[model samples]
Target: METPPKTDIAAALNRVLLTRKERLRSKNHWAGLAKIPTTTVLDAFKGSNSTIDTLTKLAEGAGMTLAELLAHGDPDWEVQVKIRNTFRSWTIEDVDGLIRLLERRSGPRDSDAS
Candidate 1:
């Protein structure tokens, strides 16, 4: 299948920030999260060219990978990316526990009913 065109980088970054509005109340908050200067964050939001390192820091601040941040248009993919990023630091037992909890909350699957 043909790949969908990506959104502008600045717009994608803005969308991610909107999703994190509760925590990132302002640009300064975002910069703090990214551990970058406020001016750098401002430049990024304005579509100014930034170094890969800066972009990586920004992505990390947003709880996603650099790739995910760059490809941040799809809501479903965004959620999956966040989940995947979270899973990276989890133990297998933690993952299994989460699976069990989710399954319980979601009830039995069709296969289980059979």
Candidate 2:
């Protein structure tokens, strides 16, 4: 399939931010969270030929990984990207802990723990 237009990508990002439900509503707010300048975010959204680095920062500000943001309209792709990014950042200890937690949850429930 052909890649969607930049406008569509921008709209998707706005939609993601809107889903935040009153936490963020402005470019400046997102920029502050992403540690990037407001103009950079605005330019990227406006399709002004921003660098990947700029776009990555914008995505981070919106509580998404770069891959998730780039996945745009594809919900499945976005979810997969989020999962991949999460695993990418996991340390061995974290993975081991998660495995233990999952195993315990799947095992017989402890009345006191519940």
> In model 1, where is the ten-residue run with the lowest total lDDT?
72-81
Model 2, 1-114: lDDT tens digits are 997544356655666676653666777888898898888878767767767788787777777777667666454656755677788899999999999999988998678974
Say which candidate scores most in lDDT.
Answer: 1
Off by over 4 Å in 2: 1-7, 73-114
- Give the least accurate 10-residue stretch of model 2, judged by summed lDDT: 4-13
Model 1 scores a TM of: 0.59
Taken over the whole model, the C-alpha lDDT of each candidate is: 0.82, 0.72
Query: All predictions: root-mean-square deviation over Cα?
Result: 6.8, 9.8
Candidate 1 per-residue lDDT, tens place, 1-114, comes to 998765567877887788778877788988999999999999999988878999899889877778777766554657766776687889999989999999999986787565
